[model samples]
Target: MTVSELGLLNILPILILVVWACVLLLLDVFVFPKREQVTPLLSAVGLVVALIYTIPQFGQPKEAFNGMLVIDGFAVFLNVLVLISGLVAVALSYDYLNRMGMARGEYYVMMLFSISGIMLMTSAADLIVVFLALELLSIPLYILAAFGRPKMESEEAGIKYFLLGAFAGGFVLYGIALVYGATGQTGLTGIVEAASGGLENPVFLLVGAALILVGLGFKVAAVPFHMWTPDVYEGAPTSVTAFMAVGAKVGGFAALLRVFMIAFPSISVDITPVLWGLTAATLIVGNVLAVAQRNIKRLLAYSSISHAGFILMAFVTYGDASVRPEATAAVLFYMVAFAITSFGSWAVVIALEHAEDRGLELEDYAGLGRKRPALALAMAIFMFSFTGVPPTMGFAGKLYIFRAVIQGEYYGLAVLGVIVSVISAYYYLRVVVVMYMREGDPETHSEGWLNLTTAVTAVGTVVLFIFSAPLFDWAAQAVLRMF
Candidate 1:
């Protein structure tokens, strides 16, 4: 009952990252004032340290900070994933920022801060903590989106993201208040316990959950709330777009999985239909709209939205107690698959991007196969993975998700996923076709870290699938403690 009893070490990974970000912020101002390169390296080092701290705590399930946070397999899995994402972002940002004349130490600092928020979100056990974590995760992203100062597009992206993000935050906060009003509890476990005993205002609870879903749907770029995504992705710096694509979705889904599965299962019957509609609409809209885009970033933005729909397919079974663990595991695995494939694709996009944002059109990618065969091959692999082709992690991820959906008896959703995935191939392969089948000189940067990121992620996307069973088992283990 006392503050002294609140375990702190249980969340050491999050703490280390938060403290490191603060220290790095100061170091950026004084020690590395002129060295843009040093900050990213240091940022990567901090993320590695946090990852090390995280990996050791995977099996030790416990609550901390007065039950506001938890350390468990799920938390550890996401913590490690988020940390790795931060490191990859650092690598991608190292040279690109300097090339575009937007190199600033604060860029890395903001990323570190945002990543720490993601780490916190994965472990949050209370609604209050989830709201705090959501804000911490989002605020830095708004600033980072605008990091390319004076550029009209970047400025517009930042402001639009900021305004919309704040509106989404309002939805979450109001939902939290309503949930609290209905159950008089903010802790997820307590909310479930209170609801199971019979909520006096179950309607309030249902509406609140819907509002929270709306807010998170925005974060994951689900349809009806996804208007901000394409503009932001196209306008923001490529490195920021790459990181934001993965990090924000992970954080949003983490909260969504935890809160809905833990706190709202008692009312799943009322909410299951909503999840189904979101999944179908998001999948259909994301892929259908993407076919009309010529800009690569916008296409990938829609790709991100469609992938979110695929993840939502697994989440559609959140109400099925018998299939919940399997669904959770499928979602975790698919996130890893999506992250690897996404980063690799974006790396190729970044390689081809120029100072004034040339090389971004679909036509700009023509002849990339002849000019940069390796990068082109990597892009092809990424595109294939996105299309759910074999030997790639995306295929494995979609397989797991469809199987889980089938197990949950959501055959229609699974079938829709397949058809849309086929639709997605049209645009995904268009890039590859342009690269190999057409003819236009494509200029690309051959930065060491950038190339390494593309190569490693491209390799990981394939290699991990070959060993997907163990990886999936690990993901399964992560949610064993949840229920």
Candidate 2:
């Protein structure tokens, strides 16, 4: 391999982040106090610079690290998404950490490190690389979840997440081992060649793939594996929760799609039922349970699980040759929609959250419309978008996903998706109703950074819908280059 391909430039954005995070860590200790606001500002700057580097790489796919890392339009799309989310996360974290008495440079550093891991996962072409990326992202998050020391709930979240993540990591590693034994390769391209040519140990391949699904399902918070989500999301600092909701899912889905679409396409027929079952269960359980949640964080947690189900419809249709492009495009677009909406909603949550996690109950949202009309209006738009209503990006994303499902002739799944969406509308709209119709003083931190983040996301959540056609076209072009 050429030195150029093996060196840092081979993964320029990740390399930039590594240095930036380290610098921030060092500076945090020497030059700043625990609650210094400069840390997040610097962190955001670094993330933006990294994004600028990533932006120019669009449409040009290449391989590095002896082809173990593949940078294509798809990877570019996901990396940019994660990086941009990192910027927003930084924006959300500054005031939140202060109010919670946990502001520190290390928090931002951990987040930056986690984002680098997410970016790495997007470009990973080898199972080993993906596993490493998974660990790289997860460890920092584990620390961040517990950053609010002395908070028993935060401690519990940290411990539970660590234990579950370790278990999931073990599964991914063992699955990689089994897949290697079955195909005599760990690289996606090599695995494809082995599987497509008719592996002698197809049973091993099947079992390995199943194990991988279990492992990734945990990260994406699919049903059964999603038991960790509600508790962790509720206990962790809301800022950390906001970041994980989007960043972790993006990374998980990136690896899942890269592995399944590239290495296991031939086996998709055997695996379709499993995928279908996962998506179906996730949607029903997520939406059903969310309705019972009084804690807003837990409600959104389950809501996230349901969104995962909605996005997975794209992969269900992946096996259809005629619809593959549209299916892939739909998944990509859905992720973008989910990231923006989820992040924005969480910003509102953080604004309302007080020390010791007060004011987090659904009822606490009452009278928000009277006290803070702008915030209430933004929350309403997010609620409507989450319901997949028109004039928002969520609708466009759901439209693409449903169209893909219908085109693939999975009418039952499409119907289930629609029905569950109707069920979801009840709870999502309930928050809005409480905000406008009910009466009580709901306090907010009123942090400028948090408000800015919420406003931008709310605007993007709506405005993007009008320009969604271009996004779809870009997604189509990107998906075409995936092969």
Candidate 3:
């Protein structure tokens, strides 16, 4: 494409974000000049503006910059979701950061930068773009994770996440190099064409694919690659943890689905078995391990891992062109639902934490219902929804995925998912039980402004189920255009 064409197609979104980030950085450094003065308000407004700017491109498929990036329904859908989640995270972070005494404009800037990476990731069709976006998303997160600089736990979480994340990035880059060598191409379209032409040397291609999967596996926190999750979730600031859980998962899954479904579809036979094994192991290990955790954050981290397994079930059944639409829609809807519910859960934890100590333990939640009825009610909704109870979006998400798996004749995986959902309920409901059944500590009091987040989350959780049909339809339409 000519420079003018590329500028028209690719540069809009990229330029919008670049300009936005630069402005925010300038305001933070020169105008605000103090951490306390830099509010998350600017970040929120910028994201909203970005979302509005990107919304008009939803139905058009525009590829630019030598076809390295494609803006289509799928990319637009994921980008909108990421932006919404980022906005919510920033809103929740304002109070949470101030309460924890970690309020800084850099925090919001880093979040926006990570969000920019997520938006780029979903649109990336070239290996170089994918690697660049991944780093962009990850580097900001590393600093955000460690933004609680003076706190030992925060520093530890940041260091551990950075070390592991860099290692995973290496694996991903190596895999890309191998794939490039095998196929003599670095774009998804090129790789797909090369694979279809019959492999002159399948060794490098297969190994590259495996390494890529490993790298992404760590990002999504699939089993065996999930050890860093619990500690990181427990130690990092709750807002960052929430963002990591929801925003990171959405971006990771977006890139993963694009790479696997479009670029490497022919390798289903090899990839399917591996994913099946990972799914089974993740479900078993995540739920089983969660049963042993008294720390609510850690429990939720494991829960998130198990949920990843559930999402993978959709991919396992994604081969038939007829079922692909439903499968993809199920995964997308599930990600959205999980994001809302998980954020609500963490917002409560962050809000309730005492100034002297982060209050994430199950014991700390005791008598929460008695002390703060509104917060307790919100937590109850999140817990119940997470457990796949009726009338919540989580149940609807699980039901759709399970139904899709069965329709594709994956009866065993479907049954396994159902069984694990039951097992997950025990731990999820434990928090609810403690809130309602226990007595309150005489000294404990509810934190302020957390109610705003809870209220928003609760409404989202309920409305998601009520409006799930339209959301599913939108996702289905987006998936149909993916081909």
Candidate 4:
């Protein structure tokens, strides 16, 4: 499609964000000093504007650039989630950066760029677009992960994340080439039509799909492809880790769902088992390893991985026409639930974190309830949410996932899912136990922005649970065109 044929209205949200990010960067350099904090405010304004553009595009799905980019309900739903995550990341980073003496305008710039990439991924209807968008989102995160100069671990995180991420990218690029060679199609809809019509050799198509899965698996931090998760999550600046935990996971799954569901549903026979194994391994490894973590960051990293497993379960039985919508909606709800609670938990981590390891270890959380009751209570709520306990969104998310799996006739997977969630409770509850039951003086920085984020997320966790019916209905509407 020609550039003129690609209507601007279909992509206004992405254009607004990318352009605003560039303008915000210039403003940070020429207008706002480091101490003035103008960049973050401007950054927030840019995100709000982008979100405004996004909401209007929700009711009608449009394909621009010859179907290379499509503005659909799925894209609209995920764009809202991605934009909200970007805003929350900024809020979480503000005070943490100040406390660690790592405040800088570039951080927000990179985040904006990354968020734009995430938005692009959700709307991409082609594999080439997916790969480019993946890189756009990932490179900024690699820089942010190692943004802390002069710290060995931080430097190490940058290098490790960069190298592994590059290798994963290579897998994706090669897979795309193979899939194209096999079917002579690069766009997801084209690929779907080609595969459905019966390719001469299905081997190439199947292998290429597996390779693509490997690449996206790395992005989502699925097991066997998840080696870098714990170290990077531990080594990176805390707020970056928090952002990566949610933003990266959500983006990865968004693309994964779109590409596989929209592009390769014809090969569901081969795909289902792969996702089943991925779901089982990720759930077991992430939760089991989290049980042994001494560092809170590492624990959450594993927790993030385990949550990926739950989301992946929705994909396991997605080939069943009857269950596909529920699977997709479950994923959407789970991502929302996980994102809010993840940030809330990280806010508590930032609140208690001291420079040079003053409040990082699990032991450091002792007596938090006795000291800062509100913060500790927020942390406790996040823990309950993570454990899939009642009166929280996490429970509702798990319930939806389990029901989907069961409806898909994967009863064994559903049962195992419950068992792992039960196992996860022990580790998640440990934080609350340390905060309330144990005794020690845990030093913390109580910045206004930080406290506000915590309370908002904590309240959101329980409040959303009460109103889950409407949320799920929204999610179901979002996937109306998936079939």
**Index of the highest-lDDT prediction:** 1
Please identify model 4 stretches exceeding 4 Å from their true place.
Answer: 1-4
Off by over 4 Å in 1: 1-4
CA lDDT of each candidate?
0.93, 0.92, 0.85, 0.90
lDDT of 2 by residue, 27-70 (tens): 98898764367888898999999999999888778878888999
Q: Please report the candidate that would top TM-score against the real structure.
A: 1
| For model 3, the run of ten residues with the poorest summed lDDT | 441-450
Reference-based TM-score of each model: 0.99, 0.98, 0.97, 0.98
Model 1 misses residue 89 by how many Å? 0.6
Task: Give the distance in Å from residue 38's predicted Cα in candidate 1 to where it truly belongs.
Answer: 1.2
lDDT order of candidates, top first: 1, 2, 4, 3
Q: For candidate 4, what is the total of clashing residue pairs?
A: 0
Q: Worst lDDT window (10 residues) for model 4?
A: 29-38
lDDT of 3 by residue, 232-346 (tens): 8877888899999987788788888888888887777788888888888888899989999998889989999988888888878655657777888899889988999998988
Q: How close to the true structure is residue 352 of candidate 4, measured as C-alpha lDDT?
A: 86
Tens digits of per-residue lDDT, candidate 4, 120-190, equal 89888999999999999999999999998778888899889999999999999899988998899999989
Error of 2 at 328 (Å): 1.3
Tens-place lDDT per residue, model 1, 74-178, is: 988988888888888899988899889998888998999999899889999999999999999999999999998899999999999999999999999999999
